[model samples]
Target chain A: MTKPLSPGATIGILGGGQLGRMLSVAASRLGLHVHIYEPAANPPASETADRITTAPYEDHDALTAFAKDCDVITYEFENIPTEALDLLEQHRPIRPCREALRISQDRLTEKGWLADLGLQVAPFADIKDAASLDTALERIGAPAILKTRRFGYDGKGQARINAPEDAADALASLNGAPAILEGFVSFTREISVIAARGLDGRVACFDPGENVHREGILRTTTVPATIPHSLATDAVLMASRILTALDYVGVMGVELFVTDTGLVVNEIAPRVHNSGHWTQNGCQIDQFEQHIRAVAGWPLGDGKRHSDVEMENLIGEDMDRLAQIAAEPGAALHLYGKAETRPGRKMGHVNRLR
Target chain B: MTKPLSPGATIGILGGGQLGRMLSVAASRLGLHVHIYEPAANPPASETADRITTAPYEDHDALTAFAKDCDVITYEFENIPTEALDLLEQHRPIRPCREALRISQDRLTEKGWLADLGLQVAPFADIKDAASLDTALERIGAPAILKTRRFGYDGKGQARINAPEDAADALASLNGAPAILEGFVSFTREISVIAARGLDGRVACFDPGENVHREGILRTTTVPATIPHSLATDAVLMASRILTALDYVGVMGVELFVTDTGLVVNEIAPRVHNSGHWTQNGCQIDQFEQHIRAVAGWPLGDGKRHSDVEMENLIGEDMDRLAQIAAEPGAALHLYGKAETRPGRKMGHVNRLR
Candidate 1:
């Protein structure tokens, strides 16, 4: 059996946003040190981390130095460049290995992997150009999403093709980048299963949380999602299958579309997720701490929820409600120490337990 | 209403140990920065804090600079010297005020304050010298505890005077420090109420927790303490009385002895107490966050416990159980990140929720 990482051991984190900020806080609680590597001058995680390497992901020298100091390298976001991972992996062990990220980084690859596991996904086809888009749209039909295969977040890098004539404009909009056309699925609601898998292959999943999005940014997630019991079970099972297929370690959030027929795989996050934020107030162990434990080779903690909870993200001007949230009797208000509240930026969040 | 402390506002913290570390974590969660002034290098709070000023409590220049940058000053431990408080308060707001610290720092003063509140306390008398010790021993009787009035913690600076002849020797051993001789209370169990008071004079208290001590150090604290409802109510009332009398703005813990007669106040901590650690798992807001909210001039959070919990401190060699503790299914482990764990040092703690 692998020895558990000691408290003073450093965990290297990529992408130092609020997720990294929270991960750093959770790591510190476990007596572990964190080294955050981000391009931003004032990444949220840097405030709480023991060390910060303010360098681009392409900087091999800095990445090497960071990797050499860290006992294990993990990431806050899945969009990290493959070259960065290859460089860091040379010096230290990286959890949720390169294979997992490779499969999860692109829409086509993620859907392909999910289909291979006998899980149902929204119908999709690869599109390279106008001609290919025409052919793909012929197969998937109208009202399909044309999304770039990589580097797209918060609804960026995507367009909708409503007709064959519109397909050409959509292809041109991506600037000739590789893209995929996905058939939209009519879903009753969207839900996600946030779970952790330990080195010993033990998986623990929190109950699925129903999610609502605003402009592709998560607005709120309410736990004990109002889905059929069988559908919830199916969502959790699909998540476990993905974890096992990737041989993944650490927490992975599996977002699913709960349709009238059944659950359809949406995408997988390779780290602690926004949907799981309710665990901070609802469960005994939160996703951040669970992710830390998984990478540390410690046993997985119980992910049982003691209360039904709702987590709301405070974006930009939403932070103005901090005082009102704090005044709420059963609300747990959490504000990240970001110096500025840019439009659409996640300034903080509040978890209310009932 | 007062303006909310902004993101760049600096919070001054005294006694930089694990409690201070957790407090800094909570403060950063609210976008408020912290500057920890501690005597030791690499104090636990320093790892995550924005700045660390390492200097002895007597360093006037360092204290002045620390106070000047902070919007408000608060402490993690109650044992800080009164002179240090006087110096810091000159430049910034000091929550819980100097009067609370003065009454809590000495046993005689604390007892006098409690008695003035019309509260029940063990029969006690002041002892100054051999003659005074002899007189107090006769008044308080044998099998009593003779404790130095100042600077005593975790069984230090005190001796058990089980017989009349031991009084003179015990008094001499303390080198004539002001002392308090008190008859022992035969109690069924020990319990403590951890509560917070906001600047608006609102009080919120968590359910009282039963505590067990070994060698004068807290061993474990279990919530939903096996006590009668009336007894727990009395404990909360006692804590409320103390907070009101002191005009306390931050969290304070009141330890009580449940005896045949009723509840007797054992002692009061002017800062967060170890027994309150269970709230991290059992409540929506832990004591650390509640303390930060109170000192930041924000409203106090809900201090209600959601489940029963047991918290055990990882003192010194007990840290060796990190693996087992981390593996415990429902346990939430918190390590202080201290570099060294000498005998009796509190390395971390674990909370198990039911």
Candidate 2:
């Protein structure tokens, strides 16, 4: 195992969105400084981070300089450009490794990797062109979802096909980008496990949280998920297996489908996830801090849930409810300092203890 | 009632020490920015604060610039120069108000104010010169403590008067500074209530934590103090009374001597106290966050402890035990990011949940 980072060491983060903002706060809590490298000026994380480089990822010199100052590099988003990662790795190590990103960035590759690990995943077929789309639709059948191969998030770059007649429009929705057709699985509910793997390959998983979504954006994640104990154990074990296989050394959020058969792997996020926000109030250590500890090569904290919690996202105009939320007892409100509140934009969240 | 500050507003903090560093982190958590003003270069708070002004309090231009950038000004230490406070109050509002500082800055004045508020405090006398010191010693009797009125902290500027033979030397040790002689009280244990008073005159108090001091410095603060339930209620009520009398607008740490008779007010810190560090892991809202909320004119959170916690201060060499402490299950380590660790300096603290 690599040596653990000292308290004063700097952790360089790639993206400076809400996840990076929360990660920076967590690093500061442990006496570590975070240097955020973001393209946009005055990013959300810039206010709290120790240093910020407002340069695009295309600027290798800036990336090199950022890496030179940091002991280790990690990221909040998974879609970092390959050239940028290549330049950053020359100066410092990146946690969760490039392989985890390689698999998670593509729907086909992620499903294939999970299937190769003997885990159940939705049936998927890669589509390169119109003919491939027809063949994939024929095999996957109707009521399937077609997603772009990369750079997709928060319901973007996705088109659902309800019947064979909708295949062409679904393929057109990709705009000639590579796509994957996934056969929809009949599931009772969606759940996620926020898990971590330490530098020593030690694994820890928080209790699964049941997820509820509106317009494809996550709305709430409640702990003590209705899943039975035996299934929870299986879910944790499956997540641990994925981490060990990738040699991952940071937190990952594994979204799963609870079907009549068993748990089905839906997707994996290489950094802290929205589904794990409740851990901030429900457990001793939160997912953001757990990710910081893992990337810093420190021992993983005990991921035991101490209380029942319900975390609700405050998207866009939902921030108008701040007055009511703040008035609620035992509710912890977290607001991202974004200047604009456009439609569908995540403004903040509230974690209420039960 | 004062208007609550918006999320993007800036909070100016004096004294860029650990308290300020933690306060900056708390402010950032609530989507607020902090501008730290300190004389020292690269003070601990600079690593977390949004902006840092490395100028002495004598730099009126720098102080004016800082106040211009902040919506409201608060402080981490009480020993700020009177001239600096006078200049700052002219530009922006200071939380806890100047009256609280005025009273707390002078030991004799603080004791008199407490006595006037119907709070029990140690018998004290103002000592202006050698003659007054002799007269105070005669009146207060032996085995009392002589302390400088303006700048004493952490047992500094203090001398013990065991008997009449030690009176002259003790008086000479003050270096001709104004002083206060306090009669010693035999007590069972030292306990402190961490309380907050919102802008609307509403108040909330966390449970009192028993404190243990070593060489006049706090070593440990354990919650669920061995005191009876009635005494705990008295401690909270007394702290609330003190806040009400001051018309305070932030968190205060009220230290008390728990005797067989009742609780005696020992001292009150106008800012977040070291004894309240346990709240970081014990409650939903911590002392730093509570202080920020109060100063921001937000509603006070439920200051309820959800878990039993023991916070041990990692002073100087105590940092060497971090490897063992980190390996301990459920121990949350919070380092202050101080570059140099000298004996008796507070480097960090650990909150262990039981």
Flag regions of model 1 displaced more than 4 Å: none
Clashing pairs in 1: none
**Tens digit of lDDT per residue, candidate 1, span B1-354?**
255576668889998898889999989987889899999989999888888899999999999999998899999887897788888887888987788888998899999889999999888998877887788777878899989898888788889998988877788788878889989989999999998999988999999999999998998999999999998998998899899988889999899999999999999999999999998888888898899888888888768788899999999889777777777888888889998888888888888876
Q: Candidate 2's residue-wise lDDT over B1-354, tens digit each?
A: 278888899999999999999999889878788999999998889988889999999999999999999999999999999999999989999998999899888888999999999888998999888788788888889899999998888888999999978878988998888889999988999999999999999999999999999999999999989999999999989999999988999999999999777888999889999999999889888999999999998888989889999999999999888888877758888888888889999999999887
Best by DockQ: 1
- Per-model TM-score, in order, reads 0.98, 0.98
Largest lDDT belongs to which candidate? 2
True contacts kept of 1: 0.83
Docking class of 2: medium
Q: For candidate 1, lDDT tens digit of each residue in A1-354?
A: 267888798988988999999999999998899999998898888889999999998999999999988999899999888888888888888997788889888999989989999998999998877788788888888999999999888888999888778877788899988898999999999999998999988999999999999988999999899988988888888899889888889999999998877989889889899999999888878899999989988788878888999999999999777778878878887888888888899888999885
Candidate 1 positional error at B294, Å: 0.8
For residue A113, model 2's alpha carbon misses the true position, in angstroms, by 0.7
Runs in model 2 with CA error above 4 Å? none
lDDT of 1 at B149: 91
C-alpha lDDT (0 to 100) for residue B198 of candidate 1: 91
Top-scoring candidate (TM-score): 2
- Candidate 2, residues A257-335, lDDT tens digits: the string is 9999999999999999999999988888889989999999888898988889999999988978777777675788888
